[model samples]
Target: MQDDALFPLLSALAAVYAAEPREEAGRTARHLLEAGPSHLGAAHANDAILAEMAAALAASDHPAVQAILAGAHLLPWGDNPVAAQAAAAGDIYVVCTLMGPDGPIPSDDFRMGLFWQRPGTYYALHSHDADETYVIVAGDAEWTAGDDTRLRGPGEAIHHPSLMPHAFRAGPQGLLALWRWSGDVNTHSYRMLPDPRAVAAA
Candidate 1:
């Protein structure tokens, strides 16, 4: 029953990503959709912020957002491995990998996923070998890449090249975004850089 519900939601999500004008993001999502799901294990993770995420999604009119809201409970939600290792208060967000090497849909060199962060939470600077793009599905955030920062809301897309440092601070309503990874997709190269706040406090 769950599998029946999940695939359509994933297809809706792929459509959402494919609609992006950015070449890399659109191509990666379409490729994964064509490859299809492997129907892997039913893994789940616990996080306090998921409720807030769902509430935010409920306010969105986008079809993809509605699709995720309908099937969010069926997704294999989990803590980000790098966030688990580096976060000060343990896991601050939840992720659902719909496609990747380890996700239900298998892809060797790319990944597609959803991410939700708690309200007003700050994800410090981090970098990894894979190139990444995040498409905001609901809520808002202040995103920083190197010396620049911008307030991004729903339907906005942010791209980060391999190893380019980036960070996010979720807005009052928190954040819910779809993200994709390409190039070197291995998480082993992920690193948490020095928090700028800590550096400033020193």
Candidate 2:
């Protein structure tokens, strides 16, 4: 039987990403759809892999399955160590990796990364698996390049090549963008800047 219990979890992830850029939303949505529902594996509490998978499915809709998922809940990366740094220079961020369904059964051909924004913040200079793209929504956002800076408003799409240097800042108000990856999610590159503060101050 299909793991219908995972449906609600997919819904929660989708809800959290409702305002994401089209590409990001599409990437994440595709992952969710692909993940579908599955038994996961032989039950093992405290297993790091199993734990993360359960957290990803924690928000499931099916009551019974949700109960199983409810065993532990790790809120989206916030000011938390693993994530605080991701949006610290900025205001919001959400990155989703296929942390569940173990083995070739739940393979990681690609991953989803979505970021939320607050005005006066920058996602900073960094790189990650696959080339990157963003769909802008909500407030205005500015992307900076070594030679120039481009400011974009709602409904605009931007692209960056793999290992290329790029950064972003929300305009006068909070912003939201969906970020999609074209290759392996585990791959990442971060540009070295003389001053991270400069990136933030910009």
Candidate 3:
């Protein structure tokens, strides 16, 4: 898809987020939308899985939602090499970042993206300086935040406080979620707890 395809997607994403009943989430979405430019570029790392996800979204009742996702720039899960290794082993973890300090329309205050993981994969415990929120757009997962854990499915949103340890494992059906971050957007602040290398070795 052309880079111009991203404008509608960004607008839709911002609309959905701005309509969030939660005050904080709505405010954050509006802030990002207002500050971000309409330009976007492609990362194009995972073509096959991107097609699958687009199809799945297209099949949903919300076809417009799928249209928005169709323009995503799929990214390799290589920022954390050990996690990348797990994905290489057929787990199908995919990341599509939409806005960040380094993304198309750069922003220092927040970032938003889509994340997908195949069934049975463990997204190891990790923490970051930015407060994060994940709104499940498809599939299911067992989500953990601090000592709290729950089975979150489509339409549910999970929030993680800044620097709070959390992790999740995709259930039998796999997981697909829309994620947003605020407060701190530094990429260097992400810390994988227990270590990705250790998890890979185990």
Please state every model's RMSD to the true fold in angstroms.
2.6, 9.4, 4.4
Cα lDDT listed for each candidate: 0.76, 0.47, 0.64
| Runs with alpha carbons beyond 4 Å of true place in candidate 2 | 1-29, 36-107, 145-148, 195-202
lDDT of the structure predicted as candidate 3: 0.64
How many clashes show up in model 2? 4
User: Among all windows of ten consecutive residues in candidate 1, which has the lowest summed lDDT?
Assistant: 81-90
Ten residues in a row with the worst lDDT in model 3? 76-85
Give each model a TM-score. Answer: 0.87, 0.52, 0.75
Q: Name the better of 1 and 2 by lDDT.
A: 1
Predicted candidate 1 versus true structure: per-residue lDDT over 44-132, tens digit per residue: 75535557878788777666886777677776777354554565633456777777787567778778788987787788788999889
**Alpha carbon lDDT of residue 24, candidate 2?**
52
Model 3 agreement with the true structure over 65-91: per-residue lDDT tens digits: 564565554332323212433434345
Give the top-scoring candidate (lDDT).
1
Q: List candidate 3 segments past 4 Å from native.
A: 1-4, 21-24, 31-38, 43-45, 55-64, 73-92, 195-202
Best by TM-score: 1
| TM-score of structure candidate 2 | 0.52
